[model samples]
Target: MAELSPTAGESNYSQDIQVDEKLVPKKGLSLCSTRYGIALIIHVCNFIAAAQSTVINITMVAMVNTTDHQFQFNGSTEQLPGGPNNAPDSLPAEAPTYDWSPQIQGIIFASAAYGMTLTMALSGYLAGRVGTKRVVGVSLFASSLLIIFSPLAAELGLISLIATRMVQGLVQGSIFGGQNALWERWGPPHERSRLCTIALSGMLLGTFTITLVGGLISQTLGWPFAFYIFGGIGCVYCPFWFILIYDDPVSHPWINVTEKEYIISSLAQQIHNGLLSALPFIIAWVIGILGGYLADFLLTKNVRLVTVRKIATFLGNFPSSALLVALPYLPPSYITTMTFLTLSCGLSPLCQSGIYINALDLAPRYSSFLMGTTRGLANIAALLAPTVSGFLLNQDSEFGWRNVFLLLFAINLSGLIFYLICGDAVVQDWAKGRKLTRL
Candidate 1:
């Protein structure tokens, strides 16, 4: 086997590296390739899932009535619920706004997470038993319908809105596990990193797009439009998913015979040749996409797989932790603070190539179940992080933010250290269906 020199990282020799032909396309890379296309389409599904989930976070700012703030009108300040001076006529006409308390808002923010935590493990198991195409596609369709009606639900009452969101969460909770199930069948072991990360990156892209635009849509067209537009996109994408995706290459109608053989042969070799296989809470798209390519490139150059996972994990965790430590000390400019925060967030996606993909390496058969278990547990943190931060801020605003950053730094640092020490890429015996016999 070819091996890259230890000093190769210090040089540009990677440019001259010859990737194994089994993983590389002899005809040259093209998006039209079947597996790549499937990955890309799954990326869109992730995008929609993320957009629907987080758009509410931004639009809620516009949805709530700012009763405490006074608006300037006719050179005299008047309370909100009245028109502001010289407001654009083209802006959305006044819509009903909620007077939800901070406590209620907190519940709304965490409502989906509650549902997600409850359903995630079950969804994973279900995806494996059923099939990824229907599980994921149906979830997306159901969530989209709920989002479209979210505005109506909110107007009806707080309970109605929460119920709608909770149900939406229940459906979307299936998506991640379903995605892993798809990769189990569709991804060749050699190409696992790039294929999985490419799809996962869509979540980041969707988050960024919704964050950047959700506010504007809420401000101009009204908050309801944000829900409508994002939800509608998910609905429209369903038909394509049902039409194009199959459980595996062997079953796909349009996959060429050569590509089918290549995928199947690659996976079979990995099972016999070696054991086992194979993010962040918020991420950036570019980092993930690039990190996946880098990982696959390193693997192609004969770098040990475990070593590559460690490298990616360190890059993902350490710098972000350090950045969090320094964030509280940055100059108080929002621009500067936001720049640093974005940098920290952008660093997180590197794990896509590391611990994030490790589940598939350990056990292809149970990838979905493992993903669900891990993600569901992590989301407990997601469910509580905001509430915890809010509680801290309520006690003391300045130190609360500082403590939050410090807490994140400590958590990330500890996780990085543990993973660096104990992380493995080897498949476990159980993953290969070895039964433990009683003595």
Candidate 2:
């Protein structure tokens, strides 16, 4: 067993690395390989799942109008002369109406996170046991079924709709939770940052597709089509994913000898660690693209991988803290405050390459479990954001927003400090199921 010197944080694979001839190609290191294909598959999986997750938002308005309720656009809806449908002037059959209290609507909206928060860590554990591809594949396929039935659930009653959303939330939470674990096997050592970033960027693409395409679809085709379209996409992708992917290099039938050996050797040095928190996913895509490249670029320069990780973390999150602090004060202009907030969201990418992938950096073996734990922690933040925002937002007052921004600043500051001193790139002792320590 070759071991890297304690003093040097970089890998020493070039000289000492060994490959199994059975798995290695006769030719040499090649750019286009089975690994990149897996990355692309991951991209599609995230894209479909994410699109399914959010497509409901666009369809909500349409759902409200579809079920036997009267939508009055021009004049008051009044019952006229005769009894029932025979009334001389009246138009259709009378259907029951449901009321949406502000509180009830809030509950319905929050139902997904309720499930997500509960299942975050559990999802990761499942990934290790069953394999990440299976876990994510099952989750998405199940979520698609729920989404397709969503309209029916809405019409059945409020309870049914809420139940459906909660289940969807619970199921979808694991898609991301399992990614690090899945990649633990699929990504080659050198390609970890690039591949993780690229595959995860699908979340951004998914959301963008839904927001722009979903809106148009719902408007022209009706609300049910939106769900059907997105859900169907997920349904279509599942078989392809299962057929193509495997748990790790050793398990993949098509992976060549060289690639397998390289991946296995890479895993030997992979350590387990954790950092980074969740941001609203749409905002994460840009960060993934920019941060992934930046981290990989720095790694090539001989900067200690740990230092590179921290730099990405600090660069990504610290400015957002400052920007968030000032956001409330941005001269009452629409664009000004909005711009500040956008930049704050934009800077989040630094952490994508930074602490986000630290789980893989720390412990390649347990990456999925740690990734799930991180996601669950992020879901707590996601769960809390609405409540805190509600408390600080005043429909007519700026003071409410001021308090919110201040709270955000504090949260970012806390994370920044935590990652700066404690963040690491070295493999962790606990990742190997041994004793744990901080260096």
Compared with the true structure, all predictions reach lDDT values of 0.67, 0.62
What ranges in model 1 sit over 4 Å off?
A: 1-31, 69-91, 269-411, 414-439
Candidate 1 per-residue C-alpha lDDT over 279-318 given as tens digits, one digit per residue, 9 for 90 to 100: 1212344566678789989999999999999999999888
Residue 264 in candidate 1, Cα distance off native in Å: 1.1
Best by lDDT: 1
lDDT of 2 at 113: 55
Task: Report the C-alpha lDDT of model 2 over 95-178, residue by residue, as the tens digit.
Answer: 222344323543565577546644444666667678887888888889888888887887799999899999998898878766
Q: Which candidate number maximizes TM-score? A: 1
Give the C-alpha miss distance for residue 305 in model 1, angstroms: 43
Worst lDDT 10-window in candidate 2:
1-10
